[model samples]
Target: MAQSIYLGLMSGTSFDGVDGVAVQFVPGQPLQVLAASARSFEPALREALFALQTPGHNEIEREAQIANQLAHDYALTTNELLQQAALKPSQVQALGVHGQTIRHQPTLGYTRQINNPARLAELTSIDVVADFRSRDIAAGGQGAPLVCAFHAVQFGAPDETRVICNIGGISNITILAAEETTGGFDCGPGNALLDYWANLHLGTPYDTNGCFALSGKVNENLLHTLLAGHYFALPPPKSTGRELFNSAWLNIRLEKFDTLPPQDVQATLTALTAHSIARAIAQFASRCQAIYVCGGGARNPALMQMLGAALSTAGLAHATLSTTDTLGVPAQQVEACAFAWLAMRCVTRAPGNLPSVTGAAGPRVLGALYPR
Candidate 1:
């Protein structure tokens, strides 16, 4: 039997960069991470992609250009990882590229992740698995937070309940409790609001260690207001993005506190992220015994502190808080490896979406394959 190796690529909600991972998964065996790389989009392109996430005029042409550039950039990173791994295109099974999610409206029955799979396949000379969300959406699923299945597979504990959290531009969690069906959903904003607020004031992309936010105190009123978002109130099997929580949304809420210090507002946003996730965990997975965080937010210490504080106050003070790295997978590589796992599943004709997690009609083999 040949080794089953798949390359996974992910450009998360933050649009900060694409994380490419190459892994080999032999059936019934632990997957091995072979190589990984991170490639960032140029600032101008990043802004354009961010703009397209929301409504605006003259978007069609701009979006097309952006998609092409994204594919080109994805190929660049994929090629680099392949070279570093010293593997030929033929040796790898396929590439799973989660294109930039410009819009995800599963309720209305459509989700858009803009990536030219055909072009990517042509450039990489490898089979491509893309559009991993639409099929699940068609089956009445939220079609977001698609990585929970991967989390359940990689991090599920036999004795203790484990919560796997990926905090990108948006935040989400996977609850893997022993003997209980694994489940997860988008908790809320992860770094989106904080980054927006920081750029608007500190002129940086994200809060390093949540320093700006640490400098200010959380405004109880603003925290309360931000928590009132309708999406947060939705039941499980739900997902969200910049569509509901972005700079514009933040700006609208900020108008009332025009005189508030920028750092205070940033602090409030960070708290909103922490409070929302902690609240979700408490409400959905009260039995959670440990939390393993991943993605960009794991690097933010102040935010982690707030999460710990919130969780401790909720009477779960003994639950351990840490990143996925403690479990062998690096924080940033988990999502990328997830896409790789999804690609391998698709190639093997295995189901990807967990009906219980996404509220889909049934389990389905997610992602459309574009052959090279």
Candidate 2:
């Protein structure tokens, strides 16, 4: 196969910002990241997005406006990526953009990502690939953890089992077993709840290096309450988003601990993420030798420390944990690159979803193309 350049744009469930990358993929060689750029969502836009996570009045109009706004943000970031890479729109093959997902409910046979791909294409003057999840949902799959297929290509080991744990707003693990097919699913809440609490108590977008969490101790009672959620115990081929683990959900669970110290709550939330992820690894990828983490959660030292302890408790004491930066990809950029890889597959007419990972009826090409 010949080499081609594709740009990828992503705004994860964290609703924090847009991350864009210009990447070149060549046959038999590791993919090269030409350029990367990130732009945070303005406070107003971020609030609007968080509000839309739940049902609200005038949602159709609100969501449409937000989609338009998101396309503009995506285009701006894409332009920055292109400029940084010293490439023009005409030189790029296409853009793979994963829009802001407002609701991910594959069980209900629908998933919604707010995006205006045509507008993005018009703004950027390049072919655009968007709406990557619905097709998998149509095929009876979770329509998520889509990054696992990309993980298998970029991080898989032939002689040893590896786990790629991506902790975005929601945490998910991709199991790349040396002797078995790849598997993954949403493990549980990631930075979403932690960030929410941080924003609420500290007036910051996220806890810097988990300092708020490190200042307190994990309350086992609250931790037990969190672990008892039905989602954590569900088998694989399942996924979740803010739809289930949002502020409202956390508030309800916090009613019993109203007098609990805010810092303790933060700490428990961090532990919740660590324990849930550790449980998933133990249950599905018990034999995994090393776990390479990606996404925003990798930056949190407290969370990482908690994860290490949680792993020891889960009987995965021998498993080592580290960030994907050691694997030639920055934690924040893996998902963006994954979508770029996915877009390449779509452009080549190859299947993108792995039936084993997503429980899709079969592999399916996963994106909608909008030509410039």
Candidate 3:
């Protein structure tokens, strides 16, 4: 039998880097993550991406240039993963690439996740499937938090409910109940504010293990003020990104506290993530027996502790805290692995989006294919 391998590439909202994974799927067997590799976007590339996120003059040309640069970087990451797995490109069936999402406005009827799938296909010598969100939006859905299907596939348990909380640039959650429809949505900022505040104060991309936040005390006043926003109260079947929860949003909130401690603000942001997520889980998955966190947040011991405490505070003391690693997939690898599985679904012409999760008109096969 042939090796059923596929490649998945993801550069989340953090604008940090690209995560690549080569996975092997076998019928009636466990998922085989053959290899995984990551590469940070160049500083210049990161700056360009951040700039292009909003709007500017001459953006058309600059956006194209940046897209080209991204293709080059993505190609490098893909080749590295292939090398790590000691496999050739021809052996891999297809590559699923979640390009950099510069603007995500589902309400406005469009969301742009930029990537040159044609170029990626040419460079990698493999079939490519990208642009997976537009169809869902056209079908009147949020076209986001697309991992719920993957969460159901990978984490669903027959006896107990499971929640997959992925804290990336923005945090999202997936509920897996054996008898109910799987669903998820973006809760709010995850590492976005934490990373921004850290870079502002420490000149680092992110606070290492949330150390800076751990050193500070949570300011209840700021926490309450931040929590007062209607975003959290609007309920699920919703999604968000840097567009609403970026530095500008933070500055507007910070304006009221003229003399607040910077580290305290970071602590409050972390608390906000914890509280909002805990609240969502409590409301949506009250019967959940386990909460498995993934993505970059899993690496932050301080944030994890806060999340556990918040869950206990929400009367979910019976719930256990764990990472996706405990279930045979590493935290960082889950998203990439999800894309790989999604690509497999695409080629198989199987529906990928879950209507209960995205609120789309109905199930549809996501992503456009770029043949090799």
Candidate 4:
């Protein structure tokens, strides 16, 4: 039998760019990437997205336009990938479109991502699989950390424990235990809070390789205050995002400190992310034998060093996905690749959600299919 091909598209919280990956999955073999492409969100669109993250005046109309614009942008991205690979829409099985997430309030039983998959299919003439979160949320789950199944397929080994830590706009970890154990959940803020601080204080989109953070000193008191949030104490199967850790959240913490250097603030924010992520791994994923870091945060050297230092302090060894010599798949493309895998699963009528990861009542098939 021939392998099936699917395209996955993702615009994560980092708002850095859109990643699209073409994946071929053989029925009984590991998934392989055929081609991949990424295009940064244009400045205007990115600004609009960032604006929506806060309490804005044009919330309703802006959100509706964002949905339409995202679908159009997704179609353009898919078309570019197809053109580059010399593949026609009919040649692929489906496109997994993880629309740009504007709000992911899964606790309310709905997560709003701003892409119309049906419109994407209509424009691109490809079957689209989207809105993968609702099913899990409906089944009494967090509807996040959905990549656990994908992590299992890619990193799960028969004899060794593995941890897949994704440091996207929001960080999450999937623990693939030797045979008896398998679970995952959002660790804490990934690039969200750091990016928020950078944009506010430095007037830049991000710190760019942790340069700003490296120049500053860590504020222990601010770090302690940031860590005191209720979300940090929440047990596994819980998830959070900009909604909880946005500018307002940061201001509340800043109010406690009379004054501080901007770089120091950056340093403390960086520490918050690294420390919270490390703490989660220690508390929930201590048994895992290896930790593989991915997502945008993987690119920040200072954050990685802090994470390594924390792991060492906890008496745990750490390594990144690059260390395993698996950089064939770009860190940015992993989430997008997972969506492609999810599309294939939907087509095969397979369950994509891991009950252990999402705290779901049971295994559930995910995603809504939109026919071309």
Candidate 5:
């Protein structure tokens, strides 16, 4: 039997690194994750990318250089995947590379993922699929939480309603109900603010195991203020990123409570993620019997514990809380695997965005290809 192989690369809102997976998709069969690899961005490149997240002088040239750097890093990870899988580039159908997102404003009718796909193709000698969001935005959709479609196919169960919560820099959810339409939307800030506070105070890229959060008490007033943001009240078919939840946004809010301990703020931010997600599920997916978490936040025991408590407080105590590993996909790899599945759909000229989740005008074939 022939193998339908594709590679997916993702550098999500966390700006931590690139995660790549080489997967085989057999129709009516479980996906075979042949190999997985991740590479942290060089400190300089990571800082440059983070700086690009906001407006700056001489932005155009800076962005170009960073994009090229990202492509080189992506190629390095691609090489690692090929080595691990022992498969030539020609054997893979395409590379679904979600370039780092510097801006995602679906309301503005444009979203930018900085990447030089042509360079990636040149370096790897493989067909590359990039820009998977703009088409949906053109169709009047959120152009995000695109993983919901993949989640449905990869994790849905016939006997139960399941919710897949991906907690990257921004948290999002996908609802899979038996015989019901799959739906999802971004809940709110995930690890973005948590990581920012950790880096700012603890001198770490992230709060390992959420020990910092667990060490402090959540400031209820701070949590209340964080939840009062307009984004949380807005209905679904929506998405957000650093654009609305960056350091400036947090610092401004923090101005009101300088006396609060940094660890306390971190604890509140963690709760903010949990409570907002719980609210989304309670209001939108209250019927979901299982909540499977994936992404960096899943590894945070403190955040996980808070999420479970929040759900219970939201009247979903019966719902189970666990990571996607129970479903055979590691928590951190779900988004990367999703892009791989999307690349397969793109190469086959099939629709990849779900109108139910992204609220597109209709199904659209996502991604632009740069053929090797």
Candidate 6:
């Protein structure tokens, strides 16, 4: 039998960069991470892509052009990673490309992510699995938190309950029970508000280790007001993005805090991220034995400290992917690797969508395949 390897490419909600991970899978064996690489998006491309997230008046033709450009950029990213891994296109089974997410209003039964797989496949000369969300949406699912399946495979334990929390632009937690039942839902905003405030006040992409936030003090009044949002009060089996918690949304919350300092606001926003995530875990996953943190937010020391404090207060244990003793292909590479695993599942006609996580009607196969 031949070895099966798949490349997973992902551009997360952070709009920061593209990440690709190559993995090899053998029958009845654990998947092995072969190679991984991440490339930051160029300023121009990033700006164009970010602008599309807003409710702007843009032409359909322009959107189409941007989609093609994104696909090209994704192909370039894939080619670079493949070269760095020293693997030929033929050595890989297929490419799982999660195109940039511009809009993900699954409630309306449609989600738009740029990057045409056919164009990408033609450009990269590899079979492509793209559009991983639509099928789940079609099946009355939110088409999100798809990582739960991958988390179930990698982090699930036979005798213990575990939760994997991914803090990207938004935060989502996957709960794996001792009985092997899995559940997940969007907790709330992760770094999106913090980054927005930092860019506006500090002129930086993010708060390094929550340093800027640490310089100030959290505003309890403001934090309370921010937490009052309806999304935070909602139950599980839900997902969210910049659509509900972006600059505009933040500005609305800021309207009430006329006396708060900008730096203090940054501090409060960071607190909000940590508090909201921790609150969700406490409320929904208190019984879980451990929580493994991932994504860019995991790198922030201040946030980590806050998480630890919050978890301790809740009488829950604080943990991270790092505590597992291996980089395991790095925090940044986990989601990209997930898409690769999803693509592999798609090729095999295996069910990739988790019904309990996404509130989908039931388990379903994920992704649309585009041939080279």
Regarding lDDT, does 1 or 5 come out ahead? Answer: 5
Superposed on all Cα atoms, the candidates' RMSDs to the truth, in angstroms, are 1.2, 0.8, 1.2, 1.8, 1.0, 1.8
| Count of clashes in candidate 4 | 0
lDDT score, residue 46, model 6? 74
Error of 1 at 288 (Å): 1.2
Which residue ranges in model 3 land beyond 4 Å of their true spot?
Answer: 1-3
Residue 56, candidate 6: alpha-carbon lDDT: 75
Judging by TM-score, tell me the better candidate of 5 and 6. 5
| lDDT, residue 6, model 4 | 91
lDDT of 1 at 265: 91
lDDT by residue (115-205, candidate 4, tens digit) is 8777899999999999898898999988898988998887788876777789989999888887665788997889988888888778888
Candidate structures ordered by TM-score, highest first = 2, 5, 3, 1, 6, 4
Each model's number of backbone clashes?
0, 0, 0, 0, 0, 0
lDDT of each: 0.91, 0.94, 0.91, 0.84, 0.94, 0.83
Error of 4 at 301 (Å): 0.8
Residue 77 local lDDT, model 1:
94
For model 1, residues 36-76, the per-residue Cα lDDT tens digits are: 99998899989999889877999998889898999999999
Question: TM-scores of the models, in the given order?
Answer: 0.98, 0.99, 0.98, 0.95, 0.98, 0.95
Q: How many Å off is the CA of 245 in candidate 5? A: 0.7
Find the 10 residues in a row with the least total lDDT in model 1: 310-319
Write candidate 6's Cα lDDT for 136-248 as tens digits.
98999889989999988877778767778888999888898877568888888999888888888888788877889888898989889998999998887788888888988
**lDDT, residue 106, model 2:** 93
Model 2 regions more than 4 Å off: none
